[model samples]
Target: MARTRIIEIDPLTRVEGHGKVTIHLDDHNNVDEARLHIVEFRGFERFILGRLYWEVPVIVQRLCGICPVSHHLAASKAMDSIVGVDCLTPTAEKMRRLMHYGQIMQSNVLHFFHLSSPDLLFGFESEVEKRNIFGIIEAYPELAVKGIKMRKFGQEVIRATAGKKIHGTSAIPGGVNKNLSLAERDHLLQDIEQMIEWAQEAVAIAEGYCVDHLSLVQQFATFNSSHMSLVREDGAMDLYHGVLRAIDASGNVIFDQVDYRDFNDYLMEEVRSWSYMKFPFIKRRGNLDGWYRVGPLSRMNTAGFIDTPLADDAHQAFRAFAGGRPNQMSLAYHWARMIEVLHCVEKIRQLLHDPDLQGSDLLLRGERREEGIGVLEAPRGTLFHHYRVDNNDQVTFCNLIVATTNNNEAMNRAITQVAKAHLSSQKTIPEGMLNKIEVAVRAYDPCLSCATHALGRMPLDVALYDAAGNLLEHRVKDGR
Candidate 1:
């Protein structure tokens, strides 16, 4: 009889938060199951109850250091509903969009140059010690410098529009607490051309990588799944505001311009025994077949066109690379991300040039309502924040469906695909092989810290079971 075994990569590196990979092998050494498990839990949804509704935007921003601006905006948008405001003031909306675009630019640049570029630039099989941002700096110092400068520009834009770089309490229920000054606008304008140039260069770099490694790009953790994002009524991409849209694997739009307040009408979250992260899927399709993807790749596939000129051109080129179909190759996320970064830059320029950006009309007063729902396209993907307020404007219930949670099932399926293709009967696994598996998870660029919101460090454990379900070997790593 063939022997059964399991392989696990504890404490997945180069990604945010605590996670691990587990692959179960059958008696014939065939892959039985693979899962990407999130092992931490933070009770943000439960604990936030009883707080004032106005406090939510500030509190939810604490969910993630990397993309707090996303939470801030989403929660603020929801709170806007609680205050009975259907629309924010023109200036308030413009400032918020500027800040949101800044978050996207910073996040996409960080992911591409700092996290994923190391693998693409250095090769997945390179020496572990040298396959990081530091390695990239050592080899291509100019590129590293450009990335740093672009990220700094994004942060500066955030600082100028919001009060601070991280967790800025500028966005409030009725509107923003601040407005852009001509000086601040001028400061950002000075860097707009530079940021745009760098974004274009980044796109070219990613496209070259996709072409040079066409086979690996196509094969790496590839799967057919539905994509979801926020889009304008005319099908243009809108990160800060729009209706939710979902498209099938064949690129057919299943739903478009659906109000996020009724998310439950189409989307549902499922709990799994193995992880704290919830799996989200389409309600009508059921869990097994309803799983869909969000984030850079999904946004690119679902968006009809980007409003910015340069980004729209890049989008067309990227679609051509996939032969005008929805891109299923997981590695294409990097390409999509670069296009997003370019869009952010161009959009930032347009916003900065608007005369309304300098207007003093930042806040709108309104009476309190009992329920509110907010949704926005975060740097990673679509983020939803729903809250119900009591008569006193205190929060009664809160629910958050973050971007990473939306992609949970897709990440698992991607890992399984990578494991089965690379780990077949290999008596011993190399660090490179393990890195490939991690690469699949990284393609989604998951923010586990935001996904689970756990406080204490969580250790990672892996175990092998025999055909009879008896544990044979185990490994553990303490998280720092």
Candidate 2:
């Protein structure tokens, strides 16, 4: 009889939050199953219950430190609906857009430069100690410096609009709290051109890597799947606000321009016994086969065109390279991400020159409502925020379907594909082969802490094992 064994990478590195990957090998050494498990959980939805409706916008920011602005804005937009405001003032909308674009630009830069660049620049199987952001700083100092400055510029934009870098109370129900001053606009303008130039360079690097390594990019953790995102009324890429859109692998529309308020009618969340995170799928397509991907890759596939000039050209080239079909390569996410960065910088420049951002009309209000829903394209993907308020001004219900949760199933599939491709039929799994599995998960850029919505306490455990199936070290920490 052949022996069966399991390999686990607990507390996965480089990605946000706490999670692990488990790979099961059959008796013949062929891969049987692989799963990306969320070992940690945070109850932000439960925590928000009973709080005043107005405070939820600021409280939701605690869901993620890296993309707090996304949660903050999404919650605020929902509250806008609760207050019965269908549209915001010109100054208010523009200010919020500026804040959102800054958030996306900075978040994407951090992921590409610090988190995923090491694997892309150096080979995925490179030495563990050397394959990191520090190594990039040591070898490519100029590129590293540019990444820092670009991120700094984006943060500065946030500070000017949102009042702080981490969590600001700028966005409120129906509108924003402050408008951009002339000094802030001038300061941001000074660095806008350089930011655009650097963003372009980043896109070229990602694009070149994919073109040069076509075979690897095509087959590595890649499969034909459905994609979803938000798009402008005219079918342009609009991250801050738009109706819902989903497309299949062949680039055909599954759904388009559906109001986000009725998300319940189309989307369903499936809970499995094995995972703390929930898998979301289209209700019409059935839970099993309706699973789709979100984030930069899906956004690229769903967006009909980019409104900006330079980014539009880049988008056209990217689509042409895929023969006008949805690009299914997981590795191409970096390229699509950089294109978004470029588009953000372009939008920032245009917003700074506009006089509406400096207008005094900041707040608007109308008839009140009990329930509201808001959806936006976050740095990771589509984010949904829904809330119901009681007459006492207290929150009665809260439900959040974050970007990471939307991609949970897709990430697991990617890990399974990579593990089977690289580790099957091997006598012993090398550390490098393990890194390949990580590469696949990292492509999704999942936020485990945000996706995990399980309540109560759970214990944590850590174990180190040698190639000979012997435990080298074991540790466990009790959870409250």
Candidate 3:
């Protein structure tokens, strides 16, 4: 009789929040299918009902601690529309931009150095015990220190602009509540040059890995799909603000410069039976084929160029490496992410020198509207916030498409590609083989709690089964 089995990996490590993956093997032990299942669900949308519209920007920060600022700003932007403010003052806009760039820079640094560095620096199949941030600290102390300082710099920017690190009240309905003072600016400037140098080195590390493991990067979890991001009108990468744009794998524009407020017209979310996370796709292409990728890789694919010189140069080399086509290699996300880190630091340096940041005009006001939509590129990808406020200023409806949720279909595909390539027909499963699966998922840096709109704790269950559906092995992991 032919052998067949089903493998389950619960509570995928290294990514945010709770989730699991299942891989099915056919009669010949060839992989039949793979799925990344999101098990927990929370009623965050419903949780917003009846809350004052003004409270949304603050409350939404509860979504995910990892990228709280993304939610804060996205909700604030939507509330801006609710108040009918189309454009923010120079000071307000610049402050928010600074906060955003800091958020992205620090988050990327944490992911690249503390989270994924162990895998990249020490091979994905290396010993699990030593394949962690602590391991990096032990072996590469200087690199570890740099990562910590880089992240601290980003957090400090957030503190200056947002008023505090975790969840801040700086951003209000129409604009920011605070601006950077001279002292704050001077403090940030002290580390600006060093941060830039460290960011550039980080990019080199990622690029070196890709170049050294060209074959592995080319084959492992790599596939061509549509890419999407927010780009400046002239097609430069603008992480804080811009119109939505998506391109096919060949670099053909799928949709260009569409206002994110009308995103419902161009995109639709499909609810799958097994996963709580919704699969979002472009409406014109339909659900099956319209699923596109977002985040650093997609940003690199869609942006015409990086506006900053150092980042632009790095971007140019990255593009040339892909022969001027969309880089579909999944592992290349590390390289692209580092490039964004460089861009963020450069923008921070520029913003710190701008005198407008010290301006007193921090807020704006206008006629109120009942409904509003706001979208921005978060650290992971594009984040959308929509709300309907009652006449009493209470939120009547709410919907959010978190960045990680936007990459839902893409992460599943990546996991499947890795599973098939690494686990198919294997007589015995090794921890290293499983780590490869996680490396693929981690490439996208999914935030499951943010995606599923859930909070609180949940247990994890890992199970293995025979072809006939008999459970062969099972393990449980208690929730924290």
lDDT of 2 by residue, 108-194 (tens): 999899889999999999987778889999989999999989999989989999999889889999999999999999999999999
Best by TM-score: 3
- Once fitted onto the true fold, the runs of candidate 3 whose alpha carbons sit more than 4 angstroms away are 1-4, 456-462, 475-480
Query: Using lDDT as the measure, which candidate wins?
Result: 3
Poorest stretch of ten by lDDT in candidate 2: 454-463
Better TM-score candidate (1, 3): 3
Residues 113-140, model 1: lDDT tens digits: 8888889988888998788899999999
Q: Order the candidate numbers by TM-score, best to worst.
A: 3, 1, 2
Question: Could you tell me which 10 consecutive residues in candidate 1 have the lowest summed lDDT?
Answer: 454-463
| Error in Å for residue 182 of model 2 | 0.8
RMSD in Å for all candidates:
1.8, 3.2, 1.6
What TM-score does each of the candidates earn? Answer: 0.96, 0.95, 0.97
Task: Flag clash pairs in model 2.
Answer: none
| lDDT of model 2 at position 198 | 97
- Scored by Cα lDDT, where does model 1 land? 0.88
Supply candidate 2's per-residue lDDT for 414.
94
- Please give the CA lDDT of all the candidate structures: 0.88, 0.88, 0.90
